[model samples]
Every structure is written in structure tokens, then in C-alpha cells.
Target chain A: MKGTGCISLASCKEGQTGKVIAVLGDKHVRERLEVLGIRKGTVLMKKVQQMGQGPIIAAVGNLEIAVGFDLARNVIIRVEV
Target chain B: MRVLLTGNPNVGKSAIFSKLTGIDVTTSNYPGTTVEFFSGTMNWKGKTIEIVDVPGIYQLNPEAAAEKVAAQMIATGDVLLNVVDATNLERNLNLTLQLMKIGKPIVMALNMWDETKHKGIQIDVDKLSAILGIKVIPTSGRSGEGISCLADAVLNAKQAPETNWMDKDRWKTIGFIVDKVQNLSGRKHTTIEYIQDLFVNPVLGPVLSCGVLYAAFTGIMRLGKLIEKTVLSAFEKYYSHVILTISKFLGGSGFLHEILIGETGAGGVDFEAAMGVLTTGVYVSFGIVLPYVFLFYLVFGFLEDLGFLPRVAVIFDRLLKKAGLHGFSIIPMFLACGCNVPGILAVRNLETRRERFITAVLTGITIPCMAQTALVMRMVGENDGIFVLLVICTLLTVWCILGLFLKSTVKGITPSLLMEVPPYRLPGINAQLKKIRMRMTCFFKDAMPYVLGGIAFINVLRITGIIKLMGKLAEPLITGVFGLPQDAVLALIIGIIRKDTAVAMLAPLNLNSTQTFVAVIILILYFPCTATFTVLLRELGAVDTIKAVLLMLVTTISAGGLLNLALSTVYTPRGLLITEILIIILVIEILEPVKRAATEKKQ
Candidate 1:
């Protein structure tokens, strides 16, 4: 499973499930994401990504969190095969 | 003893607080609705207990303003009333564990418990209580179930010793606890779930939003007109007769009569032109403005409770990005359409000062309140209606242009949108009415003074000849640059006090359609009214407030000057509109490169 390709959460296709490999950003961005359950090792399913550069939605344990484009770009995830 | 109600955002903490305390605080379906703490007292077992509804936060350690407010509030509480959304038990437990670490006596309310049944979520309340060494009661804020039992538990709740688990990984502990007490039975996708999916679908989302907005607009218009035509007209008929009798007794011509009854004619009081404290004052605030404001809050509260707003925010995030804002900024802009004070207050929810600044400035400079929009429609739109459209479109363009300009120059981080898109639920009619009633009370208390004061101020200006003198003084700018008659200056001056009054003031000027359009645009762009200005100062500090006001001045002058030239030069209104559109395109085209270069330099 770890051998599957890793990609930025922003780059993931809709409906794809992945584990967040790393949350790369400043302390503020990382903390904001973490509180919403987007921390390292948490699995999230890509619900939708609006208009390429728009915010991305991820489903983590029945909760849908919308991550902004810039912040979403910093969320690196490992695609689960 | 003080009990602080705290929870994750959108977890119905506020709803439960309202239930616990019987205080009608604003409760909505979105996060960040309550940015400040509200305290109320409840009597339990003959003891008065103070309950503080702290702003929602996902963690005890805070970053955003609202979260910081919550964190600050937690220290003062004697008991922690942690409200947990039962369906999302695992995530909500993250915050509960953090709260439990404070060593304060804590009671848990498994809120939204009613929904857990339908969603196939089962929680063994007794087991969870035993595991955490706390009382956990199942309650539904919507149904008011188990509230008294929760209150009883809260009163008798004992402090737990500082947990040894605090040294361990918190999420790991939460996972362990949830695993023991929680079970989920798989259920088929429901219609609400399907509608929720449709709301966020990229293509369908925008289309649905348009449909929702159009429906809301027409509903507000139809309802507002119904109230005005039926209730207001009946009110005016009986009201005018009594005031007319008083006018006749006072001889209807003196200064006293002018102050009270205004200029009464054979047809009685023309409330619009009465210029009296009693006549136009009451008419404008209660008759013309109240119905629309009532409807706006009604519709807004419905949409808010339906949990549709966050999805709308998601849809508009991309466009708002150009302005250095995200989709969350839409809430403030939408609220501003009702009034700017609440709009400005909502700015505290924005994470960064930069987003707040842009949202505040754009709202003050461009967005017209519902009252002003209604009056403008009646005052100007009654003639052509196209001019109202022109004014609205021009303000929108300014919002876009000014946003782009401010986004590029302002120094700060534009935090990305990370928010929960709460599931849609039927808006509780009782909660909606309570929210609207509270907001209407605020309108009466806050706005009525300004409306009446503005009318009295205008009458003083009329009596003292100051208005005429000022009109003469501003002739160069008013007549030369804006192409409005000299008398139109008074409207611009009173516009600072109350925008609706300013538009109503234009009614007496009887300007042509072109002049009406130009003047209305300037009125909107010049500055925010007194109430909004005070809030703007408080929300955005003095320095940024001054910057916003200065931007308003520049935007007003340039927009007014350019619009005047275009309207005067173009042969027809259509041509003028085309010129406006062309100018917007040209500005965006020119700024695109500048923005690109700025980004490149930053990289």
C-alpha cells in the first residue's frame, strides 16, 4: 500500500481514498488542518475539488472538511490501492 | 457556579445553550456564527447558575479569533458543559479530552442524539460515562429531550482528578474510548445525503445556488410588498388621519407643526416628503424598511439553518480568491446586504486581518443594505428600473476591482478555507422565529434612532439654510463632476447618517434617470453609514479603518467622475452600460499582468 504513488491532496482525483502522508505548511496552516482531522496517518476520501484551483473537500470519518486550494496543496497524501 | 457550554463548531452547542439557559442567543447551522461569548443565568434547584455559551472550537489551544475567545472563556468557568455531536463522536471527543484535562468538573451532553438513531449510530451512554469518569447524557437540542436530566447532571457533577491519560497521545486515547462505546450500523444513502451531494457538485452547485437566490429574492420582494400594501397602507391611512387632525389644530404651518406633522397638504401627509420627525421618520423606519428587513432575516435564517450557506461559500471560493479572500468571506458580504454592522461584526470570524480588511472595505464601499436597495428601487427603479440594475452591477464591479487591488497590496496571509460542510437539516421554525425576533429587536433599538435622528437633522438643515449653503458650496463637485443638481448635495450629506434616508432624500430632487443612477452609485460608494462606521472602527482598528475610508473616498470620486462622463457622453443608457462593462474589462485586463508580476516576484 505504501508503494502506491503519493500526491498532494489537491492533485488527487475525486472519490480516491488516501492516507495523509505529511502536512507541509507553516505552523498555523498545519494546526488549522490538524484540528479538522487532517493530520498525518488519517485516511481521507476526496469528496470533490472545485474548479482546479478552488477548495478541495475530503471525507474523514463521516465528516467532510473543505480545505482551501493553497492549504490543500500542502497536504501530501498516499493513495490507497 | 458558572458552567461554560463548549463544543466543536456546528455541533449545536448554541442551540443547547439556548435550551439550558432559556436565553435566545443566535443559533445557526454553520461555524463561527457566535464569535463572542454570551452569558445568561438559569435557576436549577433554587440555585442561580450562570451559563456562558462560549464560541465553538475544535481544540483547547486556539488560533482563530473565535477560538481564542472560547479558550479565554474556559478559564473562568467552574464547570465545563461539553456538548458533543453524537454522530461524529470520534472527532468531537478530541476536544472533550482536551477539556477534561483541565481538572474541572465536566458533564457531557451527547447532542443531536435524535439524529444518531436515524443515522444508525448507537452509543452506550453508561459505558462512555464509566470510561471517562463523567456523566454523559443523551440530548437533542431540536426536540428539547433530556435537557432537564443534563441540567441535573451538570449541577451535581464532581470534578475528575487530572487524568493520567493527558500524558498519552490524545487522539489515540479518543480512538480507544470510542471503540469501546460506539457502534455504527450501515445505512442506505438517504435523500438528504443525495441533496447534500448535489449542492456541492461543481456544475450543479452554482446552478442550484442561482435558483435558491432567485427564489429568496422573489420571496422577499413579494412578502415585503404584501406587508407594505396591506399592513403599511392600513397603518398609514389611520395614522395620517390622526396626525392630520393634530396638524389642523396646530394650524399646520408653524415650526412646531413642521417638526411634527411636516408639510401637510389637502391630501394629508405625504410621508415620503413630509420631512417631519413623526411623518417620514415613522414611515421610513417602520413602513418602508421594516417589512423588507424582516423578510431578509427570515429568508437568511432559513437558508442558514438549512446548512446551505457553507456550500454556497464553497462554490464561490474560487472567485473570491481573486480578491484575496476565500468562500467564508461570502457570509459577511451576504449579511451586509441586510445591514453592515452585523456584517462588520462577522469580520472577526475571518482568520487574518487581510481578509477582514478586504471584506470590510468592499462591504462598506459597494454593498447596499436591504433598506437602501428597496428605497433605491422605489426612488429610482420606479422610473426605469434599469438604473437600479446599473447601480447594482457597477457596485459589483467595484467590489471585484477593489478586492483585487487590496488583495495584492495588503500584507498578510490569506488562510485557506478549512471548514465543515454541515449536513442539511430541516430548519426548526421556532428557532428561526426566535432568531428573526432577536435581530428585529436589534434593528429597532440600533437603527430607529439613526433613522429618526437623520430625519430631524435634515429638517434642521432645511430650516437653518445650511443645506442650501452646503449645496452651493459642493456645486463644483456635485454638479461639475457628478452631473447632479445642486440640491442633490443634501442627500449625499445625510447619506452618512442613514443610506435609506439618503435615497429617500433623492426622491424630492426629481433628477433625471441618468443623474439618478450616478447619484445612487455615489451614495453607495462614498462611505458607510454611522452604525457601520462605528463597527468598522471597532472591528478593523483605527489605522485600517482610515485606510478603508480613504479608499472609499477615492473609489467614490473616480467612480462618480467616470460614470458621469460616460453617461453624459454616451447617446443612450445601453451605451452607458456598455461603456461601464468595457471599463471593467479594461481594468481587469490591465491588472492581470500586475497581479501576475507580483506573484512571480513573491515566488
Candidate 2:
């Protein structure tokens, strides 16, 4: 997990599953993401991504969350082949 | 005794509240529908029990306004009804454990129990109750199962022992309980899951959303018109004829006669055209407005409960960003299309003050409620449909321009969208009907008096000749700038009270097509009625309300003046469309650089 390439969630294509390696943001945003079950080591899959800079829909443990593109780009995830 | 209903977002808290109290508030298939708490009273065991539906939240510490309200409400409640989504027990128990820290008497309602079975999620309710030291009742708020047991359990509720546990300990406790009491078996994918997947499909999402919205709009309009044409007109005709015959028999030219049934028109008594308190007021409210409002709410309630609104938000997310608002902001706009009061109130769901102010102002100015829109169609649609198109296009342009201006100037950040999209479910018919009934009842109880009183007040002004005097007083600007006759001033005055009535009054003024178009545009832009105005003042505060009013005046006058100029020379629908395209391109081009600069500064 440490040596594998880490990519931002925004770079992940639809239907790609990944493990959240780190959530890079301010304390408030990280806490918000934590409460919604997106913490380090949590597995999630990209369900849908709007074209261009639109929001991305991701699934974390049976919950669908729509994340802003800016925030999505900050969530560092390691794609699980 | 006050019993508070609390849960994580979209866990059927509102549904349980509705079931317990027999009072229906809006329950949509999305989080954040209950932005503010709702209260209802019920007589349980011959005691008056007050039930408060607190907005759903994930944790005790709050971020949004709704969560803050819920957190505050927890302290004031005598007992807590911790409703948990049975299908997602592992995730939902996180909130249940948090609520237990408050040390209140908690009666756990395992809601959506039926759905849990469908998804092969089995819960050992008795074991959960014993482990948590509380009574756990398996309830289906949709099907009214175990409701009586829940009611009985509330009376004997006991507080769970408080534990000095940190956040980490709380999660450990939830994990322990979930592992002990819950079991899940693999199940095949259902049709609802398939449809949900299709709705969010990148290419198909936009197309399906447009198709759904178009179908809903046309359904409401067509059904509303059909009801209005057949049943409403027949009832109005018969009632007016009967009233007129009695007035004629009583010698129809006296003061009492005038008060009862104002001056007659070509059709006997012409209730709407004549300004009478008894005849016209009753006719306008019951005959004209009720049909449209009823039909619109019926369709809206169905779609809302069926979990279609969030998908709408998702599809429109990118577009709404251009308006300096979130995709969920469309909920208020859609509600505003029916009426502005609830629409303004719905602004509470937005996270930022800047969004609330911008949305409130744009909605107040440009979005005409159904009553006004109906009248606009009746008056203008008969002459030419293109005029209707022109008026709509003008409003859209003004909306975009104002949104961009506010985005550039407004000081706060527009929070990115992070909304929960609830699973799609077939709405219960009874729930849909109850919602429509509750909303319609609110309309009649709250709004009907204003409609009646407004009409009577206008009649008094007419009887005293003050309306005419004021019309003459404003003649210079009325005739010179907007190209309407002097008497059109009275319609403007009445428009402030009720736009539909004001539009009805315009038929007597005999303005030409372009003048009528300008007049309607001005009417929509000038100000909302007294009902919406009061709500705006309460929501946006005095300073912002004043700013909104000033903005309304400037927007109306400028839009009216410009439209008058355009239509007076070289006006074609094709030309209007081309201009609209150019304006959009120009606005986007101008905003791109500013947006980049703002993001650069933020970084």
C-alpha cells in the first residue's frame, strides 16, 4: 500500500474501487468526511462522475455521497486493481 | 410531555413523526428535507403529548443549521425516540450510541423493518433491546406496523446509563452491538437498484431527468387546465347565475347590491372581472387558484416522496453552480413555481448566508407563482404564444445576469455539494394524499384570508376613488416609460396585493400586445405579495430585505424599459433567441476569469 501509486479521487474512473490513503484538507473538512465514513483505510467505489469539473458520486459502505470536485481532488486514494 | 424524534439523516424520522402525531409534514426521499423542526400535538392516553420532529443529524457536534437545531432540541426533550434505519443498522447504530450519551430515556424504533427483510438483513430485536437496556420496537412507518407498540413503549421509557466514553469508545461500542445483534445474507439485486443505477448513468442521467421534468410539468398543467375548464367553470357559472338572479330580484342597483355583486359585464355577473367582495373574491380563490395549486401539489408530493428530487439535484448540479447556489437550491425554485412563501422558507436548507440572500432575491423577483403564471398564460397566450416565450426568456436572462453579479460581489464561499441520495422507493398512496391534503389545508387556512381581505381592500380603494386618483398621479411614468395607458396604474397597485387579480384587471385596460407584455414583466419583477414579503423580512432580516426590495425596483424598471425598447423596434422570436444565446456566451466568458482569480486567491 505504501509503494503503490496514490491518486486523487477525482482521477479515478467510474467503477474503480480504492482505499482512502489520506484525506488532505482542513480539520473541519476532514471531520466532515470522517462522519460520512470516508476515513483512511475505508474502501469505496466511484459510482458516477459528471463530465468536466462537476461533482463526483462515490459509494462508501452502502451510502452514496456526492463530493465537490475540489474536495474530491484532495482525497488521496490508492486504487485497488 | 415532549417526545423528540431523532435519527441520522434519511432514516424515516419524519415518517415516524407523521405516524405518531397524525400530522403530515413533507417527507422527501433525501436528506435535509426537514431543515427545521416541526411540532404536533396528540392525545395519547387522555394526556396531551407534544411531539417534535427534530432535523436529522449524524453527530452531536453540528455543522449545518438543521443539525444545530437538532442538537439544541435534544436538551429540551423529556424523552427521545431514537429511530434507526433497520436496513443499515451497522451505520445507523453510530447515531443511536451517540444519543445514548445524552442519558435520556430512549425508546428505539427499528424503522423500515420491512425493507430490512427485503434486503435479507435480520436483526435480533430482543437481543438488541437487552444489550442496549432499552425497548426496541420493530416498526414500519410506511405500513403502520408496530406503531401501537411503540406508542405504548414511550410511556414506560427509561434512560440508558450514561457512559464516560470518548468518540473512539463510542465507535467500538457500536461495532460490538452491530456484530452481536445483526445478520445479513446475500440477496439478488432489485428493480429499484437497477433504476437507481440508470438514473445516475452519465449519459442517460441528463436525458432521463429532462424527460421526467417535462412529463411532470405537462402532467400538472394539463390536468390542472382540464379540471379548471370542466368542473370549476361549471360551478362558477351556476353559482354566479344564481347570485345574479337573486340580486336582480332584490333590485340590483343599490349599495348593498354593489357590495354583493359589483358591476355586471357581458356575461352575467362576470365574477372575476367585477370587483366584488362576495362574488368575485369567492370565485377567484376557489375557482381559479385552488385547481392549479391542488394539481401542482399532488404531482409534486408524489415525485418528492418517490425519491426523484435528489436525482434532479444531481443532474442540475453543474447548472445551479453557475447561479451561485447548490443543486439542492432547485427544490426551493421548484416549490416557488407553485407559490413563493414556502419557497422562501425552504431557503433555510442552504448552508451559506450569501446563497440564501441571492436565491431569495432572484426567486422573489423573477419566478412568478402559479396564480400569476396562470393569469399570464390566459391573458397573453390567447394573443400569441411567442409573447409568452419572450417574457420567460427575459426572466431567465435576468436571473443569470443577477446570479453572476452576486457571485462576483458576494463575500462568502458557495459550499460544494455533498448531499445524500436516498434509495428509490414506491411512494405509498395514502402518504401522498395526506401530504397534499395537509399542504392544501395550510393554503386555505393561512392564505385564503389574505386573498379575500386583499380583494375587499382593493374594492374599498375603488369605492373611495383613491385608486383612480393615484392612477392619475402616476400617469407620467406609467404611460411614458412602459407605454401603457394611465388606468394601468391601478393594475400595478393591485399587483402588489395579488398578481393574478392585477393581471385580470388588465383585460379592461385594452392595452396592445407589446404593452401587455411589458406590463406583465414589470408586474412579476416589481415585488412579491404581502405574504411572501413578510416571510422574506423574517428570513433575510431588515437590512437584507431592504436591499432585496431596492434590487427588485431597479430590476423591474430596467427590464421593463429595455423590453419596451426591443419590442418597439425589430422584434422577432428568432432575434430574441439569438440575443439570449449571445447574452449567455457573454456572461460565461466574463465569469470564467473572475472564477479563476477567486480560486487562485483561495489557494
Candidate 3:
């Protein structure tokens, strides 16, 4: 699978693996995400995508974290297509 | 010496702390369960050691309230006991590195060690400890493995020497350490992981949650009713005979006799209608209420430990977001169904005061506690099962409408939901039973005084002619607006004390079916029971609690008045039900778009 340039994590299809490129949102949110180990270069597998603009579940290493719609849209990830 | 137990959320810090100190604090599979810290002391090796289970946090700088609390606690601790999840070593180490910078005497426990092996994770504990310059113990907090060694390590813990790693590249240092000490073999998806996936799948997730919750609700109700019928009836039969014998001993009908055994009619001491301190009060508290409470806490404890609540939260996030709440609000709402006190207490878990205020208010207004639900089921269901359904539908509609209203009017932002989803694990039966016992003890302690005192006070008011005076004073509003008789004013008055007892009070009024339906709905929406009232005050403070109570009163009168009008005018129950459903749907349709626009603008 070749790496697609970069896309909003919100658009990542379920079961797709990606490496985080940038987190674009409020500084506090960025810091909070950083604390959860979802900062730049972290590889995440999109596990579950809720219907509509709902929260999405992604795995960082072995830890699974739920990211809300707005925040997930702000997370830029390079997907392996 | 104070030893603070610190770790990332859901890493079993509370489990370890409970094991060490023998204090049965609430431990669950989800993050943020321990919103507040608990301290307990134990005698370790002839020395007293105090262990504090600090609210879990991921980093030391601290942005949230619970994180700030953990940060403050770490500063004052004599020793730091850092618990880490063995399987999620990389992420758990993020907090460990930050804690080591505090320069306190620190020891590390590899919690959930038993799961690591099955998950194909191998950790060289000695190497990790050597590299980090801290005493590391491989311990399973849930299984009580290597706990004594952990305690011994905490006793002899030493400060981890500071390293020269760049602050900007802390993750790099963590990566280096993890690569050195941790090994992973290829593994397939486990059954638990597969179930976790199914719980978050869009289509199946909602179905499963609804199925699980509905099953739990009906299961508890069935078991509770069976116990109430069989065990309580058996006890009531024997106890009534004993009480009737004692009444005859007191000559069967004096002032003291009336106070003790209540009004003894030709049928002897009637437990439900007697209204004496011993007869009705005991039956209302134990026979009517205790079964539901016991069953509720048991099922709730199991769900909480199984890590299913967060999945429910995630599934409901989109709909709840429309109401200006994060999905996590589902947790406290679930708690409130069991009882409102712990439910209100759990509101502190929300990140913003606005979310907390809104959740607390909606919960107080709409969610009837288990005891009240049981009584409502018996009373209204016996009259017309349709009315019971109506009552539930009415409260749910009110809940959604009130939530939307609060979303538009509340002054702060509701932060988006971003939380860790802990994996599922079977709850230990022993720990589950212990938690249920602790909750039952708390319930009885908080409720007994109010239950007995409220009944005693009601008796005094009746005997002293005060109730008659009060009833006459409130007659116009009771009869005119609510369409209830003046006798129902007593139930409304006692409703302020306990809703279950208030519903029981309705039995003696000989209310017709319509009046019963109206009275039950009003009792649910009016004011929270006194026990819940105090908790609301403490949790939300005076100003918010007052606002909540005022909202409750307004909603109660309006809803009650509307129900009376609808029931009296409609020739058919089907028309009434359809009208109620249409009104609910219309309200949601009208309010939802406004909330969405407002949230989008804010974003």
C-alpha cells in the first residue's frame, strides 16, 4: 500500500492505518491529544467510525482512544492506501 | 508516610490502592471513574503507611480539574507509586516519565501483568527498572499478584536520578526504553477485542447497547418484583401476625398503639396502609424500596466493571451532542436511574460547569430513581399499564426538551468528547459483591433517617391536625390545577422527602386512575427527594441547585396540568397517547436545528 499524502482523520475509512502528520485545533485540545499519545508521527488504525458527525475510535499502539467529530476533522493523517 | 498512587486513567491504580489499604474504593474499567481522591492507611511491616488513590492523569502539567488534583497531590506525597499497564507500555510511559521528573521517591508497578502474556507482550521488569532508575515490580492489581512485593518496594523506594533527555524529545526517550525492555510476538484478535469492535460499529453498536440496557432493566425489575412478592410476602405474613398480637397486648386501640402499630382495622395491622412508624415506614423502606436498590446497584456494578458504559457513551455521542452534552453524560444519567445522589456526584466528571449544571438539572427533573420507578410500576401498572408507559414517555420527552433548552441557554461551551475506551474484562465476583455491599450500606445510611423521620413527622402532623390545615391551604392549586383531590396534598408534601414513600402515600387517597396517573407524573417531576436535594446542593452549589429546583417546579405544574387536560378531554386513551407522541416529536424537531446551528457557530 502506498502512503496517500494527507487527509483529515475524520475522513479516514475504518480499518485504514495512518500516521499522524499534524493536529490542527485549539492549543489546549492539541495538548490534550498529545497527552493521550496522539501527537505527530503517531501511527493510528481507524477502528470504528460512527454514523454521521459522531466520534471515531482510533488505536495508538495498543491503546484505543475515541476522538470527537470536530477534533477528528482537525487531525491530519497520511493514510496507507 | 503518604504514598500516592498515580497512573494514566483505567490502569488499575484504584485496584492496587484498594488491595494495599483494604479500603474498598470504587474501581471500574473506564477512565475518570475516580474523579476524587481517596486515602486509607494500613500497617505495613510495623509501620503505618498512608496510600492515596489520586485521580488518574496522563501528564504532569495538568489541564483538567482532576489532572490538577492529581498534580497537587503528587507534590505533597512522600513516595510516588506509579502503576502502568503492561500491554500499553509506550503510552503509559508518557506519564511515568513525567512523574519521574518530580524527583520523589518512586516505585513502579506493572499492573495488569497477567494480560500482557496472553496479549503477546513480554516486559523485562529488571531491565526497565534499571534503565529508569526506579524500583519496578511486576504486579497484577486485579489478581493480587506480587502486591506484597509492590508494598515492600514502596517501603524502600528511592528517588529516580534525573536524566539529560531533551524535553522536546521525551517520546524518543520513552521509545528507546520501550524498545529495550518490551517485546511483542505476533498475535491475533482476541474475542474480547472483537466484542469491543462490535460495540463501536455504527449499526450494531446502538442495537447492542439498547439490547443490553433493556435486558438489564427488565431483568432487574423481574427479579425485584419476584423478591417483593415471595420473600416480602412471607415476611409480611409472619410479621403482621406478630404485630397484631402486640397490638392486642396494648388493648388494640390507644394513642400509643396507633403510633406503634398504626390504625388496626378489622383486618388487623395492614402493612401498606397502616402509616405507623413501624408498619408502613418499615415496609416502604425495606419491602418496597430495598429490593430495587439492591438489584440496581448489583447490575450497575457489573456493567461499570465490564467496561460497557463508555461504549454506550460513544454510541450515543451524536444525539447527546445535539443536547449540548458529551456522550460521557450518559454515565451519570445511568447512575441517576439507580439513585440520584451518586448520579449527581458523578456529574463532577464532566469537564465544564455548563455540562455539569445541565446534566444535574435534567437528571433531577426527569430521571426517577429505582425505588420510585418500582412503586410507579406497581401503582400505575395496576391501574392501567398504558399510563405507566405514558409516564416513561413523558419523562423521556421532558429530558430531551430540557436538554435542548439548556444547550441553547447555558453560558459555557460543551467540550467535545475525546476519551479512552477501555477494553472489556470480566468483573471479579468478590469485588463486585463488595462494591454492592458498600453501596447498600451507603444507601441505608443516607436514607434511613429521612425515611423514618418523614413517616414519623407525617404521623405527628395528622394526629395534631396540622395536615388538615395544610391540605385546606393548598386545596385550590391541588384540586383546580392538577385535578387531584385535596387529600393528595399530603402525598405532594411527603414527595419532597422521598418519592417512593410519596407514591405509597397515594395508595390511601383512593385516587381514580386518571388522578393516579397525574399524581405519579407530578411526583416524578416536582422536587427531588430530600436526600437528592442535599446532594444537588453540595454538587452544584446553592445557586445552581435553586435554579434546578425552580425548573423542577415549573415543569411539574405545567406537565401535570397538561396531563389532566389531555386525560379529561380525550374520549380514547389511544388519542391521548398519539397526542403525547406528536407533541414530543414536534418539540424535538423544533429545537434540534437551533442547537445544531448554535454549536456550529461556536465551533
Interface RMSD, in order shown: 1.0, 1.6, 0.9
Better of 1 and 2 by DockQ: 1
Off by over 4 Å in 2: A1-3, B42-48, B249-251, B254-256, B585-603
Tens-digit per-residue lDDT, A3-42, candidate 2: 5757888888888999999999888777677777777777
For model 3, state the Cα shift of residue B88 in Å: 1.6
DockQ for the candidates, in order: 0.79, 0.64, 0.81
Model 3 chain A worst lDDT run, 10 consecutive residues: A1-10
User: How badly does each model clash, as a count of residue pairs?
Assistant: 0, 0, 0
Per-residue lDDT tens digits of candidate 3, residues B1-603? 999999998999999998999999888888888988999997889999999999998888876667788899899999999999998999899899888887888899999999998888999989998999999999998889999999899999887889788778998999899999999998999888889789999999999899999899889888999888876677567888878888889897777776777787786667888887778888888887899999999999999999999999999898787679989998999999999988988888788889899989988889999988988888988878788778878887778777778888989988888888888989999889889988999989998777778888787778888999999998877898899998898888889998899999999889888999899999999999998999899888899888888888888888889888888886355677776687677665555667679999999
Ranking by DockQ: 3, 1, 2
Writing each residue's lDDT as its tens digit, candidate 1 over B497-539 gives 9998888878877788888888888998999999999999998
lDDT of 1 by residue, A1-81 (tens): 545679999998999999989999888778788778888888999998887477888899878888888888899999987
Per-residue lDDT tens digits for candidate 3, residues A1-81, read: 454568888987888899998999888889888888899989999988888778999998877899898889889999876
lDDT of 3 at B102: 77
lDDT of 2 by residue, B320-391 (tens): 778787777887888898889889988877878888998899899989988778778777777788777777
